[model samples]
Target: MQSFGTSARVGYDSSAFYDRKIYAEPEEVEDGSSEENAVPELNRLYAHSSSSMHELPDNSVHLMVTSPPYNVGKDYDEDMSVEEYRRFLTEVWEETYRVLVHGGRACINVANVGRRPYLPLSAFITADMIDVGFLMRGQIIWNKQASAGSSCAWGSWRSPSNPVLRDVHEYILVFSKGDFARQKPECEQKQATIGRDNFLEWTKSVWEFAAESA
Candidate 1:
């Protein structure tokens, strides 16, 4: 397992690998919107994000945004059945719920996968998280037209017997722990810096963005 920093770029547009968003003002974190401040120390681990998050104190985290390994032959994930993968995420979600502050939100990015028989990985994971006590909130579809599968990936092309559709999107699932009406203490310290254009675009369930290259 590896460990590393956790801060992603906030404000404006940049071609950085991480996603862009407007953040609330920093309390424990350095104001990343400004260029003057040095990079702040972030609480993040490189190991399996869910597995390593157990190290954090209970009710300490207000939000968690992560794109976990899809386990579709990723270097870090061992070969496992879909059922096994579901069990693994159960443990991860258990830990996630334990560490989250009441009403804290967890944003998970994942997608359905296919080789021969298509697997609805996102649906199963969503059910697992709900079973672990998380309340389902919303889903954002990330439409990556540029990253659409190539012709070679189409199993049988136009042949109706074994036609395969292109995999061109992913889902960001949002869930909250405990009462949704619970007040977050951090709201007082941080302010939303989102602009009108961004707010309009981001509020939509379907989003179009370029995928980060490896």
Candidate 2:
């Protein structure tokens, strides 16, 4: 695979790198068809997302679901200020908007951070996505019932002083590019139907589920 870009920072121009051979070359067929006409093998690329996204053609992806880093000193997270984090997210969302199809949907699962001053990360991301020309869709609340009692921080302990609320839920912000309804072929429409019971349950706003085990 060609090196798309060495830098992991956001907004880095990776146009200097070339070659779309990130995926495996399709096997040659028995017929006289050339490799150019062969379908490329689907493979995962482990690289910078912004750099890798540049390789994809515009209006190619149908759906995108992502959970960005919380930037709360996680091992894999970089130490960035709130402004820097907002810029990073905006750059990524811009790339997402470029790659998505006309009616493609982007779902972001995020939670607000409980720092010195509470950070509404999901709200910030929603604004950023809107600024990139994505239409606002409804948001889903993922209520993690199992983690309701996980936090023991009760500021002032029953006094009427400063108190902090424990967060046991996350927000899934949905947005679409260009249009609200995704255009699909008849065959895909038949295959994508959800069951009646599931559809009814999933359409509601709040979803009760347990948190994933670390």
Candidate 3:
């Protein structure tokens, strides 16, 4: 594990950090290995990272930005008990740890959710990550401006009986595989190029942005 960069680069928008351009299929060489063989097989557009990460070469990923399913009964996710969900996430992260370049960073975005019993999903995830060999570095609050229409959902409108607050934010938990200072050079690592405005906003622990509409 070599030192990659001393400073942390930031970006306010997730889209700003990644290029959407699709790369051409790598040409097969004489030995039959293509350029893609040089990196993780999961380093592609629209990959099922958790399942495909096992195919990635160890210490290949510099940064991973992901939003795991919240198991809140979304159409795409199966609702599992809190314990069951945590165990499932633990497995995914275990594989993530193996594929990250030493000192690599992982950014997990999750929001707290629930009705009768509120669950601090981010808190659970943070603990789970630390338990699985990652060094927690920072926690960023992503304020999504969800408070405006929240009054309608307030459980006991004007009553003091089990009232619930509107959740308008999510968390961006940062963790490193090893010492961030012991990473490789910046030239050898994947870095995000951001504009001045975005850089300034991203530097703050609390980032304010609206959620992208579906």
lDDT of each: 0.72, 0.75, 0.73
Over 1-214, each residue of candidate 2 has an lDDT whose tens digit, in order, gives 3355655545654445323465243322122211111112346664776624756767667788999999989898899998999998888898887777767789999999975788999999988887777887889999997766655465645655766677889999998887766657555656647899999899988999888775
**lDDT (10s digit) by residue, model 1, range 25-133:** 2212211221111222365455545665645666667687877777888778889888888887788888887777777789999988886788888899888987787
The per-residue C-alpha lDDT of model 2 at residue 130 equals 77
TM-score of every prediction relative to native: 0.72, 0.75, 0.71
In Å, residue 122's CA in model 2 sits off its true spot by 0.9
List ranges where model 1 is wrong by over 4 Å: 1-49, 52-54, 152-155, 186-190
The digit string of per-residue lDDT tens for model 3 on 122-214 reads: 999999987887888899999888533545464577766755576778899999876544435655576668989989887889988678864
lDDT sort, best first: 2, 3, 1
Task: Quote the lDDT for 125 in model 3.
Answer: 95
Candidate 1 residue 47 C-alpha distance from true site, Å: 4.6
Model 1: lDDT to the true structure: 0.72
Please say which candidate is ahead in TM-score: 2 or 3: 2
Which of the two, 2 or 3, has more lDDT?
Answer: 2
RMSD values, in order shown: 14.1, 16.8, 12.7
Candidate structures ordered by TM-score, highest first: 2, 1, 3
